[model samples]
Target chain A: MKISEKLARETLLEMQRRMLRIRLFDERASKMVKRGYIPGTVHTSIGQEAQVVGACMALKSGDHMTGNHRSHGHPIGMGSPLGPLMAELVGKATGVCKGKGGSLHLADYAVGSLGESGITGSSIPIAVGAGLSAQVLGEDRVALTFFGDGTANQGVLYESMNLASAYKLPVIFLCENNFYALSTPSHTVTGGRIVDRAAGFGMPGVRVDDGQDVMAVYDAVAEAVDRARRGEGPSLVEVMTYRFREHSEGLRINVDYRNSEEKQFWTARDPIVLFREALIAAGIATAAEMDAIEAEIAQEVEDCASFALESPDPEPSVAFEHLFTDAYDLEDVL
Target chain B: MSVMTYIGAIGAAQQEAMSADPRVIIIGEDVEANVYGTTGGGKQRAEQGDFVQQFGKNRIRNTPISEEAIVGTAIGAAMTGLRPIVDLSYSSFLYMAMDQFVNQAAKNRYMFGGQSSIPVVFRSAMFYGLNTGAHHSDRPYPMFMNVPGLKIMAPASAYDAKGLLRSAIDSDDPVLTFEAVPLWGAKEEVPDEEYRIPFGVARTRREGCDVTVVGVSGSLPLALQAAEDMAARGVSCEVIDPRTLVPLDTGTIVRSVLKTGRLVIAEPAHRTCGAAAEIAAVVADKAQHALVAPIKRVCALNMQVPFSPALEAQIYPTRERIVAAIEAVCADQLNAENRRVG
Candidate 1:
């Protein structure tokens, strides 16, 4: 049975909503950091939200996902509480990682948002292992890894791709090629097209127009996910996107390398606008309904921000806790 | 009782653990059949009905030439409830997978606020004598010893190798199981029944009222060999092996030093920030009042280990060097030193 057009459109719109939530949360928090509201560098996925959401929708409820440092969308897309995610950005106690891990270090284990790694491509092997776990555990679950163009160059990425392919592991390595990797362009760092390298590992790979349409990314993800379920192998999908903001809260992205007009081009192809336009065209959701959805999300973010602020800071004694498993006999340490 | 070389002892332990526990899995480059380049050919020697023979392709996996993924997968699998004894063809290759070892495996459980247990054993052949060159021969013990959550085990003889490997296999935390190149060929008689050499236990090889000698990993045998030579001159020496590094057996070594008053630290790695320096500091900190003389440390120079046999032999901390250091510390004195137990 084919997926209904209305369902696809709604999914696409939901994807846009998750993406926008991450963008605005990071955008506001980044301003806060500059104004002495927060302390710490922020790696925001401002321009690449659509791919994360589109790919996340391709996964089932129990399916797993891993992310790179620039992953605030992983938990939200995987069905985590948006308030905690936003609160985490605001450095509140109610944050997803309890404010311990900021933008770069978010994890929602309940939703199987496995983790995000600060180290480039480190999560590839972990995601492969998670996929292997799903297979071994007979869960028929899939694991998705969202890394940047820079992480694609890492040896672990190739290793992960090869191993996942060899065992036919239910793993998908999605490379969000948003041009510059922390000021270094993808072309300058990677030897060739990111997916071209993935091909060397015998896995099917493709270059998708990430900013063109959410439907484009969703279609690619669905096929790749079906292939994984069929026990075929892994796929490296290089989604070409852009970073509208700086690499972190402090650094500037639109500079000598990329034209400012490129930002305007991506914004014009904005995923929310694309999905909203598609929904309107399909007569699935009206303009007023979409406005209501946006208001609901905004209100949700606001409530969560307040809840996070009210939660007490983790006590200092909590630091000594969780050093080891309960099996650790530290009666002597005291 | 089966007689095997030190390297063979580790192989037997791996084989036994795999046979007893179906959950135990092996994944590394060329681990399936004819696992070439181990001190001995483990793949060729695998017995019938063994893990490699019985489980065949699915359970016992041989991966592509990727250490980072091999370790990372093992760590992941281990966390998800599987005992994975992953291999890094050589210790030098460990540098390629530092993130998995140090960041993921070492700190994962603690960083997760103790919500998980990383029960993985990372087995790698370490040290150099076959002239495999600098990249292959260099001993980076400092890297492993400094990692907070890692338990490092370097077995010297076949007896310790079998016992320590068994202990490491059963351990809940991650263990860095390293076998030195020189001791891989050293054979000994090991008991057939299962036995365990607990972590943080220091075993004495020789006892004396003269000087306390401490060596770790494969360096213990070298210290014992030097002690044997010192026995010729009627200079009694105490030799101790602190089996595990992270949860160091400071009690045993401290008592020995207090009894002997003089201490000698012999380590295969360089002199800088080594097991020797850590041990010396512990002795000075804990038993400084008992010291009759300053501690003497015998180790390789600060330079990298070269490939050439001559240069390699010159750079390594040798039994002769230990003897020379012992001579300097003893300084022709029947003199006041303590008697420690073997």
Candidate 2:
């Protein structure tokens, strides 16, 4: 069945709600990073909220997903609560990963967000593994991983694609191509087209050009996820999106790599605003309903940030914890 | 009792692990064809059936020459549910997937605050003495030993190969087995019954009193030969084989050093930051007052392994080198000032 045929009004509104959650959460995270609350650096999916929510909301809660460094919006899109994620960014004991992974390596397995990697293409194959697990265990679950246009150049992506295809594993390789990779234009480094490379691996490839349309991305990914659950093998979905903020927050590279015209073009196509307009026009939600959703998410982000700030820091003994499954005492080993 | 070669024993252990647990699977380059001969291709092939014939294609899988995906797939499968044994044909090729092996597999459990344990086995062989050139002839276990989230096993004999491989497969965390190509054909009597050698426990190959000789992985035979030669003369030597490097059995070595009052560490890897260097540091730190003479190390010369047979021979630590290091450390009158005066 087509996603549009069975798409409920509640589901459409939920999609926009998730997009709003990502928007306000990432915006709050940006302010907190500038205020020296979040340590190191944070890569936000601020402008790419539609690309994150559309693909994430297409799957069931039990289906697995992995992401790259720009992964704050992924778990929120998958319906994870904001408190643990915000606490993770603040390196508190209440964090999803207990203050060990920080922003770059957040993993909330409770929601089947396997983990996220700081490496560009490292987590792609891990999603393939999850797909392999689903196939081996005879489960109807599928696994999806989100990477970037820059990570598309990584050799591991092709390796993982080929492995998933050859084994007919239920996996989806989602490339969130936001045009730039840390100030370097992706086209400068990338070859012909990422979606076209799927032909070499004998898998179906779909290019979602208007990734700003939440329904468009959701339709494409839902089809692939359906095919994967049917044991029809993997597919590649490259969503054309753009980042509104810099590649990472709080770090100054001081390069005018992105021209003002192109910046204005993508910024004008804000995914949240576009989705909000689409929902209201289609009569799925009212202007007042969208406003209430936005207000609710804004309040949610504030409460999550406050909870993160008030959460206690992990004890020093935690440094030696979680290194192994069995007993390991640093004092005895030393 | 059954006599088996080192490679055969490793295959046997994997076969047993696969039969015992349905979750265990093998995936790598040409694994279905048994290209490297470490995973499977044994007499049991006809008896219990081969990998593909027994468990079918899903359990025993073959992949393209993609080391990164091979390891990453193993990590992912291990994290979710299955126990995957990934064979990256050679230790040198492991460098191609170090990001997955080190960054993903080794750091996954720790970085995720122990949310999941990665029960994956990564098998790679060091084909040094076979003259596979610089790219293929790498003893890279020392490099992985430095990584904290991994369990490393370097088995020197057929018995050890079978037992350690079993233990590695049973381990919850990610484990790496670095097999030596030269020892693949070495045949020895292995127990037909199941057995497992615990990690962090040293095996005494030879016992003596004058000097303690620590052999690592592929250097065990050389240490044994050197100890025999030393015994022919008047020097008594004790040889300790540290089966696992990460959880190194420092207590055994420190006790041996305290008794013998002299130490010598031999390893096939490079001298700098090698397993021998770590073992030497442990002994020096633990039994400093018990030492009658300074510790000496017999290690490969710090350089890229050359292709030429003669040059490669000169770089590796030989039996003669081990004997010489033992003799120097166990000298009758070992005072540095007295030796300089003489």
Candidate 3:
């Protein structure tokens, strides 16, 4: 696959911009949490930016995606506005879910980011349904669902995989193996190799070892998405990534979950640093241009924080609103 | 009007909904084989005539023994654009898919700020008259009613079974339709023409001025029979059937209680925290001024449904129990009146 100079440059810059935005957004969100601007904890996607950007970049705008709890980067990768995402984190009325769903339940349907679930691996079945809908309605759209290696143990994930295979629904199951299911090692909790389980469902399974390399992640996800859209059913792609921070925002720093040497190894392979080096080596962009892009993303993330801070808290009287779609009078039940 | 069995009415409702809308699909265990007979089992029941041949194997899918996947898939499909009708076979099996049913499907609309609506109908056969024992026979509508976003319907008659199901399938919210397994063979006049019974509306089966008796699902017929028996003894009894439990028609029940000045709630579920308790509370809160006697509840004993036929019969509400409750309320009223006159 020969990539045109212009297309490759644009793709590389866009991926870098998305990774920068996620990194900066999480940095700002962590500060906001400390200052009490954000109400609940956020599961930041600090080190797994390339996985989110690569898989989401390969998808078209009309294609669907279901994200996990540690999914602050997904909406950005899917082209959702940063203001609404930030406002939602602060529990403001201007938030995407009107302050109802916090960081974990972020959703932006405009960019085909269907929704993210607080439940682990729950979105897999939902993505299958979306894929099934496309097949039933005779649309050419595909659905991509992102979950952690911890979700590999969820029974519903296997059920969704079997159903997707049986019905030949257009779906890509991307497992972001971050090696931890909240302080527990994935290998200790998971029975076998996560990618090998896809073979049991009779679907093609691939593993991208260098998740920091955006091109590798993109190439693997692009192939899987293509196979799905071509009516070849579902495929599983396991992106071996790592998270730089704690599982949640307010967790103790020295939780003895992973050793200091292991953290140092992943920190050295930072996705943004590696991608920045790749782009400069390939003459896609100069070091000065990359620095300028980072500065611009930092300002954009600051603007999102300001917008969220200025947004008002939701009125308490309307707490019971949006419980149902129909005109159900609460007075009747009372 | 066409005479149809309760099971046949359910099949007719699904077939009619499927024929009318292309998006409506049925996913269940052994739907193609019709093994459980709820989807007009075994093909001899005229309601499910040529379903597999007409709709093909794609729409009428047979799932593996995965209840969680069955409901989760339907919720997903419904969240997208497909209107799915998922059959969980037995109401007791709902325990298996509690996470999907209670957490995911019921809370998705509210938790997502109403951005998503699950137009899925979880159909399950309920009740224990057939001696299916404890595991197969529990009526779990009260458990579902505890959830906010779920609409629960337990149709008592063939006509209501067909009509309410059409409405449930057409509804944009998640609906759990509990078809009484004992009433599957019960025959009644169901309209051949397409019709829908809206939720939260109570049907006044028999009008009377002396006392009010409320029935739900399988208990409606028992209440009506007890009403007939009470009428022979000159105690006129009004019977009300709340078709949908979540969107309960408290107005109808309250008004009937105000008119009759006596209330007796009859249900097959256990006595504690059951549908009867909810109705009794509504009447006590809203129409307590008109009460001539204490509200009586003719409900099943607070014990597990026994496997033995005789024990199950003793445990559940009977026409005799309903009659006895009505007589007690009437007698209590008479004693109060006598005390006031003295």
Candidate 4:
């Protein structure tokens, strides 16, 4: 069903908060990296706010999802506490993964957020396996996974999809096709539309209008999530979004990735603006109220950064610890 | 009462483990009535229970032929509180899942800074014999033993195999148990009960005076054979089988080397960076003063193992090489002692 009247207000409220959190976190992380506060760079999920919020909103308690490098938006969308996400980026003990897993590996399975892997398309197989586990455990949980448009071309993705479909696993393959895979565009790199590729795997496929509104993305995911819980196997959903920011903070500027005009063109139709307008049109929120929400989230993220900065670094031995239940002679092995 | 082969001991141990603990689940290719599974076996053996029926399939999960995915999921499950016995039917297939093994399971506990434990056990068979060729045959104990987070156990005899396999299963950390194929057909009487041999302890199968011989995997038998022929030749050698390589029971080996003053390491695999090198290095490092002469290693030539019987015989380490290597070490010891006396 399209956004039910009851869910419309709640969905709009969720849309505004999540979009703001993701965009704010990404912008702050970008600035932190630039200011040398966060050591490593991040593949900020800046402009692609709807994919994370929409897909996660569609999931239930048992449903889980895995993310990719551009995962800041992903965890934010999964209701991850912004404090831990910021702490992890800043390499503090207070981080979600205790600072071990930087931006790429943030995970809290409790929130149905499994993890985001460093290797592209690696999480697809894990999602498949976790979906398989959910099926075996009789949890009726769907594992929703997001890989870039380029990841659709990887052999492992195809393999994972085939295996999931073969087992009729409760998995949702969410292809966030932001046009380019690093420097390569969808036209040059991918063979065809990711939907067609999903068709080849014998799974129901959809190409959602990622840019027009968040509800469209949410509706497509709701259908897929429903089908997954009913044990109808997996579905491939290619959300046509755009990457608003550069790949990572360390990247000075994308040299040949996309034209400046194209980047400018997509930034105008930002999901945050569309979501705010939707809320305003529905009389659920005012422009002033939206600004206050933005301010509130901004303050929360700012405190998260300060908390990350104030936290102590893990002891040196902490680095070498956990290799084994029993202590290992690392010096001996070396 | 019944004589059992190494393979039988393993099967019995699995049946016993599954029967004893509901948590003990098995996952692998062909584990459920497949070609290599228990489907083709004897009538008296009672048809093997598929993982689905035995462990409820929920625990005894199967997956596609992706070793990476198999191992990755197993590691994930183990971390999330499940004791999984993942089977990499062939030891060589381990190459495909090395990241999950070496990187994830091996490093997860440490990466999370000891926040979690992976109580998963990986079982695979290794041996150069059986004409499986190079691809199917490899003794990866040396490669895995060096991994810090993992406990690598490769048993040479039937008793050690059963006991060590049991212990590896119970370990809180991830453990690797490599069953030697050549020893699979070798039969012996194992106690019809439960037992476990702790890792790092060495078992001395034989005792002598002139030289100390350390062997692992299928090479132990060849060492015992050489000891017999050498005993007749007046070169009495002590054979020490360090049952578990990583947690090496160097105490027994060092004590033997202290008495004999000469040492020789024999293995059925390549010499460079093999288990042989690790043992020799350990001896030279810890038992330096005890060694009368530099340690000598007798191992497979650094070359491809061929299918032809003659070439295969020449390619792998044999009793002749062990005997020769022991003799050379003894001769060198005698020469050094003589020089000192003079």
Task: Report the number of the highest-DockQ candidate.
Answer: 2
Query: Candidate 1 residues A120-179, lDDT tens each?
Result: 787778888877776665667888999888877787887888889889898888988888
> Which residue pairs come into collision in candidate 3?
B37-B41
**Local error of candidate 3 at residue B150 (angstroms):** 0.6
Model 2 misses residue A91 by how many Å?
A: 0.8
Query: Fraction of true inter-chain Cα contacts (below 8 Å) kept per model?
Result: 0.37, 0.78, 0.57, 0.27
TM for every model, in the order presented, reads 0.90, 0.96, 0.95, 0.90
Query: Would candidate 2 be rated incorrect, acceptable, medium or high by CAPRI criteria?
Result: high
What are the root-mean-square deviations of the candidates from the true structure over C-alphas?
Answer: 3.9, 2.8, 2.7, 3.5
The model with the greater lDDT, 2 or 4, is: 2
With a 3 Å backbone cut-off (N, CA, C), the pairs that clash in candidate 1 are B259-B338, B260-B338
Q: Give the TM-score of candidate 2.
A: 0.96
Who wins the TM-score comparison? 2
Clashes per candidate (backbone, < 3 Å): 2, 0, 1, 2
Docking model 1 quality class? acceptable
Interface RMSD of 1: 2.2
lDDT of 2 by residue, B1-342 (tens): 999999999999988898899999998888887778854548867676667887888888888888889889889989899999988878898998889988898888888888989999999888988877999999989898888888889989999999998989999988898898888999999999999998778899999998999998889988999999987776788999998886788889999999999999998999999999998888888899999999999998998888988778878889999988987886673344346657
> Which scores higher on lDDT, 3 or 4?
3
The DockQ score of candidate 2 comes to 0.80
Error of 2 at A168 (Å): 1.7
DockQ ranking from best to worst?
2, 3, 1, 4
Which segments of candidate 1 are over 4 A away from where they belong? Answer: A1-17, A86-95, A135-139, A188-192, A210-212, A252-256, A317-334, B36-50, B231-235, B308-311, B335-342
- Order of quality (lDDT): 2, 3, 4, 1
Per-residue lDDT tens digits for candidate 1, residues B1-342, read 777888778877787777788667777887776363332235445455444565566667788888888889888777666777877768899988899888778776655445457778888887577788888886776779888678888777889888998888788889887778788788899998988888777888888878999987777888999999988766789999887775678888999988988899998888989889988988998899988888999887888777777777877778999998888888746333223221
